[model samples]
Target chain A: MSTVRVVCQQLAPRLGETEHNRNLGARAINDAAMLGAQVVVLPELMQSGYVFKDRQEAFELSEALDGPTLSLWKSLAAELDIIIVGGFCERLDDGQVANSAALVEPEGRLTVYRKAHLWNREKLIFTPGTAPPPVVQTAVGRIAMVICYDLELPEWVRLPALAGAELLCAPVNWPDAPRPASERPGEIVRVQANAAVNRMFIAACDRHGEERGIDWVGGSVIVDADGYPQAGGNAHRHEQRLVADLPLAQARDKYISAHNHVHQDRRPGLYLPSP
Target chain B: MSTVRVVCQQLAPRLGETEHNRNLGARAINDAAMLGAQVVVLPELMQSGYVFKDRQEAFELSEALDGPTLSLWKSLAAELDIIIVGGFCERLDDGQVANSAALVEPEGRLTVYRKAHLWNREKLIFTPGTAPPPVVQTAVGRIAMVICYDLELPEWVRLPALAGAELLCAPVNWPDAPRPASERPGEIVRVQANAAVNRMFIAACDRHGEERGIDWVGGSVIVDADGYPQAGGNAHRHEQRLVADLPLAQARDKYISAHNHVHQDRRPGLYLPSP
Candidate 1:
C-alpha cells in the first residue's frame, strides 16, 4: 500500500461574506493541489464564516446542498482530480440552519455530515444533526468528516473509526484560548489523542484571523497513525498550509503491541450502555 | 469546596522484592503526606513491580486485599488522614492472578479495581477484570481508580466520569516507546484528552527503571479539568514526586461554554450500542 498525501489549508473567513469565503476556499484548494495534495481540507464554515450574531443571521447566510460553494468544490475536485473536504453552513427545511461538512470525491460523489454536537452559542443558532459522522471511500482512502466541536467527543470520533475509517478530516474553528507558554493548543492536543487512541490518522484544519472580536488558534495539524504530527502542530495564528504523507494502511493494523489490538481489545459490554 | 493537594509519586519497584517494595511505598506515602497532599497516587504494580516472567511468577507475587502493601497503605491513609491509591499484583480465585489497584481512604474504606484492559505481555499472565472502574466518595472528593491500559479506552474512562467521579487516579506502568523528540508521550496525551473530554481531574502515576530489559515511560502527570498539566508532564525517567493543588469543584461545572456542558452535550442515542 502506498502513502496518501493530505493537506490542511487554514485560512481566515470573513463573517457573513459568502462569496469572499468561497473564493478563499477555492484559492486554498488550488494551492494545496499544486503542492501535490491528493486530499485537501478547509476550515469549518468556509462558505459563511463562523460567529453569527443570531439564528436569523445564520439562516440568512446558510446555503442549500447545490449552493455555489459546494458546486465549486465539486467542480474543483473533478478538475484537479483531488478529494475535497470542507465545511459549510447548511440551510435546512423549516427555516433551520445546520453547521455541516462536505466531502467531494474526484468521481463526483458528495457526502455531507452535519455537526452532531453543537458548541457554545451554536446550540442557539443551528439545529444539531442526530446522525453519525459519515466515512466515505474515496480513491485515495477511507476518509471521514466531522466539524469543530464534534472532535471533542471521543465516542463520536469512535463511530467512524469503528466503521473502518482510515483518515478523519476535521474542519475546526478553534476559538483562541489561553494556554501554557510552551504548550501546544488544547484543541490540537485533543486531536492527537483522538488519533493515537484509535490508531487512525487525523487532519484537523483550524481557521485564523479575528472575526467579530473572536480569535482562532489556527492550529492545523496532520497526524500519522502513531499520533505524531507530521506537519503543522503549533498555534501559528496565520493562514498556513500543512501537508503530510500518511500511510493509511498503518491504520488497518490495530495492534500496538504483541498482545494488544486497539479495536479488538475493547470490552464494550463492560462500558455503560448510556451516559 | 477548597482545593485538594494531590501528589503522584513516580518511583521504581524491584521485581520480586515484596518487603523492599512495602518500605518504598511507606516512605513515599509519608513523604507525600509531609508535603500536605490530601491524596497520593503511586504507579501500577507498585507492590510487586511489572514484567513478570510468566503466570506462575505473577501468581507468586500476587496478594489479596489484606496483603502487606495494602495494609501499609491503609495504615498510612488512616495515620496521615489522607487518601492513598496504588496498584498491586492481585491473587484471585481459580489460581488466577490479576493486575489491580487499591484506593484506601482515611476512614479505612478499601476499594479495589482490577485492570479491565491488559497491556502487551500482561495478557499472557493476568485475568482481565469484567467490572468497571470503581468510584469512591472520599472526604476530599469523589475519587476513582483504573489501572494502566484501561485509561486508553474512552468508554472505560467515561464510566467513572458519568458515575460522578471528580478526580480519577490512574496507576500506570507505561513501557517506553519511540516517540518524536519534541512531542509528549502518547500516554500522557491520552490522559490529558480523557480529563478534558470528561471535565474531570486526572492524576496518572507512571514508573521508571529498567525491568527485565524493558524500560518505562515515567511520564507522571496531574491534569486539571481543562486538560492542562498542573504538574509533572514530561518523560523524566527517574524518581519524581508531582504535586498539584486541584480545585476539585471545577470538575463539577461541566460547562466549557455558556451553552454546553460536557456531559449534557453528549448524544448517547446516536452512538453505537456496542462496538
Candidate 2:
C-alpha cells in the first residue's frame, strides 16, 4: 500500500478572465507537482469566473474537453506524471453549457464531470448535470470528481463512495454562509461528516476572494476517513496550496473498530430498497 | 404549524443504580415539562449505565417494557401530556437482552427501538438491532428514534428524513475522542451534517460524566434543518436540560433553493436501483 499525496489549491479567480485564470491554475499545478503531489485539485471555474453576466458571456468563456485550456492541462498531466482535477465552464453541442470539472490522468485519460446540483444563480446560465459523476481508477487511488454545489447532495457523494471511490475531489466557489460564532464553518462540517460516513478521503478546494458582491468562504479542507484533517489539510482565509499524504489502505478499512463498520452497518433497505 | 419545544437532558447516571438513575431522569423530565417542552429526550442506556462488567451483570440491570421505570414514565406522560424518549437495557424472554430506547407518547403508545450499531464492548453483551429505525407521526411533528452510534451512519438518518421525519430524537452517550485543538468535536460535526443533508432537525441528548474510569462527552445539541444550532440548543458539561423551538415545517423544505431539492435531487440509479 502507498500514500497518495493530495493537493488542494485555494485560489481566487477573476470574473470572465479565461486565459489569465488558466495561467493561475497552471502555476498552481506546477507548484503542486514540484512538491510531489500525485493528485492536484483546483477551485471551481478555474478557467472562467463565477457570477456570469449572461448566457452569451458564459458561452464565450466555456471550453470543450479538447479545447485549449483542457488540452494544455492534459499535456501537463502527461508530462508531470500526475492527475489534475480542475473546474471549467463547459461548452457542448448546440449551445449547451455547464459548470464542469475535467479529470486528466497521467496515462492520458480524460473524463469530464458536470455539476449536478446548480446553485442560486447558476440555474439561469448552466445546465444542471444529467449524467452521474464518474469514478476513475488511477495509479494514485480511485478518484471521483464533483463540481461546486455537488458536495451538498449526499447521494452525489454516497453513490460514488458505495462504488468504491477512495478520493472525492470537489472544485467549489463557496459563497459566504451564515456560520455560528466561535465555530468552524458549516462547509467544513459537511465535508468531514460525508467523508467519515463513507470512509473516504475528500479534498475540497474553495475560492478565496470576493467577486461582484459575492464573498467566498476561502476555506479549503481535506478530511480523512475518520473525519479529521491530516497535517496541512485545514486552511481558511488564505490563498493556499496544501498537500497531505492520504493512506488509501485506511480508507478501505470501513471498520472503525471490531464491531462498528461504517459501510457494512448501513441499513440500505431502510434508505432505498435494492432492485 | 405549531412549534414543538424539544428538550435534551444531559446528565450522568450512576453505575448499577437503577433507582437513582430513574429518579434523575424523572427530575429532568419535570424540569423539561415545566419549561414547556412537549418532547423530552434522555441519554442512551440511561438505566444500566455504559461499561458493563459481564453478561450476568448486564442482565441484572435490564428490564422489560412493562417494567417499573417505563410504567412510571407512562404515568408521567399521561399526567403531563408530554412525550418521553429515553434509553434503557431491555430484558426480553429467553434470557435475551438488548440496548433499546422507548418512545412513550402522550397517548400511551410505547415503541421500543433497539440499538442497530453497538459500540465497542457493547457487542459483547447486547443483541444488535435488526429492524430499521422507525418514523412515528405525533401530534406536534413526525418523530424518529436512534441510539448513539446510529447517528454516525448516514443511512440510519437519511432513511427517516426521506420518510418525512421532522424531529430525530437521539439518545447518545458520546465518549470523548481525539479532537483537534480549537475545533468542535467530531461528534458535533456528524450530527449537524446528517441533519442538514436530510433537511431535518436533530436533537441529541448525551450523558455527562465519568463512570468506572470511562469519561463521556457531555455536549448536547439541537440543530435545525439547515444544520445550525437553534437558540439555547447547545449545552456542554453539567447536568442541564435545554429546550429549543423546532420548526417542524422547515424539515419538509427539502427545497434548498428554487431548483435544488435535497431528497429529490438524488440519482439513485447511480447509487443502487429501487426495487
Candidate 3:
C-alpha cells in the first residue's frame, strides 16, 4: 500500500487582486511540494475572495476554464508532479459565471466542477450550476471537487461518493460573523457529521485572514472517513500549510470492511427527501 | 406581557419497573407545581425506560392513552393545576404498541402524540405511528408534543409548527455512549441548531441515571426560538428537575416578525433535503 502525503494549504488572498492572489496560490503549491505532498487543496474563490460588491464585479473576476488560471496551475502541477485542487470564478462562453473548483493533475490534465449549492449573496452573482459533479481518476486515487456552499448540501457530496469517489475535496470561504467564538464547536460538529454520515475522507480547505472587511474562519481541516480531524488550520490563525501522510489503503479497507456493510443497511426507499 | 413559568423536567425511569417509575413521575410533577411551574415537561418513555428486551415486554408494560398512565397524569394535572407533558408506551386496543407522549391540561383534558420516527432496536418492538401530530390550543399558548426520535426527524417537528404550534415539547431518553465527556459541546450543538432552525421555543427534557445497564445523558434543556439555552439540566447529575420562566410572548413576537418579513426569502423549492 502506497502512503499518500496530502497538504491543506490555508491561504488568504486580497479580494479582487488577481495578480497577488495567483502569486499566493503559486507559493502555497510550492510549499506543499517542498513538504513532499502528493496532493494539495486551496480555499474557495481564492482569487476573488467571498464578498463580491455586485454581479458585474464577480463576472469581471471570472475566467474561462482553459484560461490563464488553468495554464498557471497546469505549469505548477507539472513542476511539482502533484495533484492540486483549487477554487476559481468560472465564466462560461454564454456570459454565465459559476463559482467553481478544479482538480489539476501532475501531467496538466484537469477536471472542473461548478458549485451546485450557491449561498445567499452568491445566488445574486453566479448562475446555479446544473451539471452533475465530476469525479476524476487520479494517479493517487479517485477525487471529487466541490466549492464552498456545495458542502452544505448532502446530495451534492453523496452523488460524487456514489460515483466511486474515495476522496472529496471542498474549497470553502466561510464568513466569520453571526456566530461567536464560543460557538466554534458547533461548526466542527456540522463538519464531523458530514464526514461520519458519508463515511468518506473529506479534505475541506477554508480561507484564512480578513477579506473585503469580513473575517474568514480559517479552519481548513482534513477529516478522515470516520469524521476525525487528522491535520489542518484553525479559526483564528493563518496557517501556511498543513501536511499529513494519509493511508489510502487503510481508507479503502475501512470502506470495504465497514462502510459497505452500513450502506447495505440504508433503507433509501423510506428516506424522506431533504425538507 | 404575561410571564409564563416553564419547568423542564428530566425524568429518569428504571427499566421494567412501572410502579416505581409512576411514583417518581408523580413526585416530580408535584415538586414542579409547588415551585410555581405553570408548565412541566417529562422525559420520553417516563413510564417505561427506553430499552425493552422484546415486544412482549413492551406490550405487557403498555397501557391505553386513557388507561392507568393518563389516569394518573390527569389526577396530577387537576390537583396541581399545571400543564404536564409526559411520555408512555400506548397499547392500542387493536393489540399494537406505540411509543406515545401526552400533554395533560390543568383541568385533566389530554392530547396525545404517537412517536413518528422509530429508531434502531425500537422498530422491532413498536409499530410506526400513522396519526399526524396534533397541536392543541392551551391557555398558555398553542403547544405540540413529540417523543424522543421524533425530534431528530425534522418533518415531525416542522409539521406541527406549520399547524400553529408556538412551543415544541421533546421528551428524550438518549443513551450515554459513543461520545466521550470531552464532547459535551458537540451534544449541545444539536439542541441549539434545532431551536434556531425551528424558530419556536423548545422544551427538550432528557432522562438521566443508569437504567438496565445503559447510562442516560442527562442534559435536559430549554432553548429559545433563537437556539439559546435559557435553562438546562447538568450532565453529571440524575433524576433532577429544572424550572425556568420561559418568556412565551417574546418568542411569539420574534417568530411573527421574522415570518412577516423573511417568509418571502425562504426558497424551500430550491433547497435540497438534508440526509
* Ten-residue stretch with the least lDDT total in model 1 chain B: B266-275
Best-performing candidate as measured by TM-score: 1
Over 4 Å off in model 2, which ranges? Answer: A53-56, A231-238, A273-275, B53-56, B231-238, B273-275
> How is the predicted docking of candidate 1 categorized under the CAPRI scheme?
medium
Question: Which residue runs does candidate 1 get wrong by more than 4 Å?
Answer: A273-275, B273-275
lDDT tens digits by residue: candidate 3, A1-275: 56688888888877788888899999999989998999999888876666888788888888887777778999999998989999998887676788888899988788888886676677778887766677788899888887765554444555676566767888888766455444443344445545554566778888777756777677777766655667752465575566777665444442322223323333344333234
Tens digits of per-residue lDDT, candidate 3, B1-275, equal 67678887776687888898899899889889999988899888889877899888899898887677689999989888889998899887666788888999987689888886676677788886766577888888888887765554443455676566777888888766454344443334455544554566788888877866877678788877666667772474566676667667555543323222112323344333233
lDDT of 1 at B247: 96
lDDT for model 1, on a 0 to 1 scale?
A: 0.92
Candidate 1 chain A worst ten-residue window by lDDT = A266-275
| lDDT tens readout by residue for model 2, A1-275 | 67899999899889887888888888999999999999999998888889887777898889888888899899899999889999999997778789999899988999989887888778789887877777898887789988767777776777778778899999988888676676567777888888888899999889887788888887788888888877433437679876899997777778877777777777665566322
What is candidate 2's CAPRI-style docking category based on DockQ? medium
* lDDT tens per residue, model 1, A38-124: 999999999999999998999999999998999999999999999999999999998899999999988889999999999898988
Best by lDDT: 1
Best by DockQ: 1
- In candidate 2, position A20 carries an lDDT of 88
- Report the candidate with higher lDDT, 1 versus 3: 1
The models' CA-based lDDT, in order, is 0.92, 0.84, 0.72
Range of the 10 consecutive residues with the lowest summed lDDT in candidate 2 chain B: B266-275
